[model samples]
Target: MNSNWFKLLMKATRVQYGENLKLNGVPVVFNKQGAELLIGDNVTINSSFLSNLVGLYQRTIIVTRTHDSKIAIGNNVGISGATIYARTSITIGENTLIGGNSKIMDNDFHPIEVEARNTDIKEKIAARPIVIGKNCFIGCNSLILKGTILGEGCVVGAGAVVSGVFEDNCVIAGNPAKVIKRL
Candidate 1:
């Protein structure tokens, strides 16, 4: 609940924000300047949640590594200790609540090939966009990977590793994250 860290973060990042954007604590990191980070109105970030004694170390991280990469968070979205790394685009719809330690990414960040792995080259073709629909709930420790799309009102269970598309008004769970129930 300190103002000092938030002030420092505000000075550090090139974030283009709308009204009433709140930060509970410092984000772990925000890298790449040419990339865009757009946060909508009434978005709240609480990176200190569920950190136990390591609350100060735990933080929400948003990174866009290239000029074409972007991260967009819609209105009334509340996230805690979430890491959103975008090589392409990652968009979260309005009224969504993302729990502590969740991760959403739109790219692999590296090539699988042994020769390419050691090089500094990136696989731009492998990256895709991640879209989470309105009024969704992403539980703690959930991992939403590249090309994943969740329709409106979907709920992702804690510790779920989600990939692919999920229909609206459903409950998604498990490692690969399947529709557990249709709400």
Candidate 2:
């Protein structure tokens, strides 16, 4: 779809965005009633297969699942086929690069207990806020889970499974990501 139409659709869905929003292909953005989904100015969301060099497996998906949930993407952010699902809150600071096919979530979606998984899922679900600081780079295919807090200029290596708090200017890699190098 064209830029104008997309902007209108976003507005109708209560997704607020700033000027110079660049869309290589249409992204799947859903904001629940009373939720907030904000995209800052000069942001580029690449959804099409050829939009990013990393070869995206799917289009970019941004959703706010709960009424009080929020997803705030800062200015000059570049997102490629990433899936950002917020049950609580997610904040991506300015000048961040979210690589292709990455997933950022503020909730587990389901309870850890098998019994609770099917029943009373909401009560058992664990949700937390994720804060990715400015100038951070999330590598391709990485999984950033709930409660993650990355300080400014952190670099997450490809395929890393990140959780917990990380200091600034570090290079993080591995399945359970750790600081591989301090930059």
Candidate 3:
């Protein structure tokens, strides 16, 4: 669609996309009901990964995880082919760039403890918030787990799995994405 037509269509549909936001690709699909999705200004989405996110939604998988969550993105962010599910909250700060085929999660659907994982039912599941701060760049095929925090001006390398609180202005890489160097 043309720029003007797209704007009009989005407005008419009541999709709360912010100003100067360009959506180049399709969404991954809404997995569960009451999942709040919020985006900010001047952003771009470049790829599609519907299959990767299918398990998170009730509509796709037969034995699906409960996913009434919220995702919040700040201004001037660009993302490509990422599968994200926010059980509580996954907040991305301003001026952040997320690489292709990444995964961000704030919950562990299955119980991790011996009793919880084995048993059919558990009192509570584990979930932790993820925060990516301003001016950060995440590399391709990275996996960011619950309670993961990336500070300002941080850069994550390709094919990495990041968890826990992280400092700012550093280059991190690897399976368990570590700090390779400071930026």
Model 2: colliding residue pairs? none
lDDT of 1 at 62: 81
Question: What is each predicted model's overall lDDT from 0 to 1?
Answer: 0.83, 0.96, 0.70
Ranking by TM-score: 2, 1, 3
Q: Tens digits of per-residue lDDT for model 3 on 116-135?
A: 67884544568888899999
TM-score head-to-head 1 vs 3, winner: 1
Candidate number achieving the greatest lDDT relative to the actual structure: 2
The regions of model 1 sitting more than 4 angstroms off are: 1-12, 29-31, 49-57
Instruction: Compute the lDDT for candidate 2.
Output: 0.96
Cα-lDDT of candidate 1: 0.83
Tell me the tens digit of each residue's lDDT in model 1 across 1-183.
465566456547777667777777656556477888888899888766554232323588888878878888999998888889998899999999988788898888777676777774676336889999999999888999999999999999989999999989999999878999999
Clashes of each: 0, 0, 1
Task: List TM-scores for all candidates, in order.
Answer: 0.88, 0.98, 0.75
Candidates' RMSD to native: 2.8, 0.8, 6.1
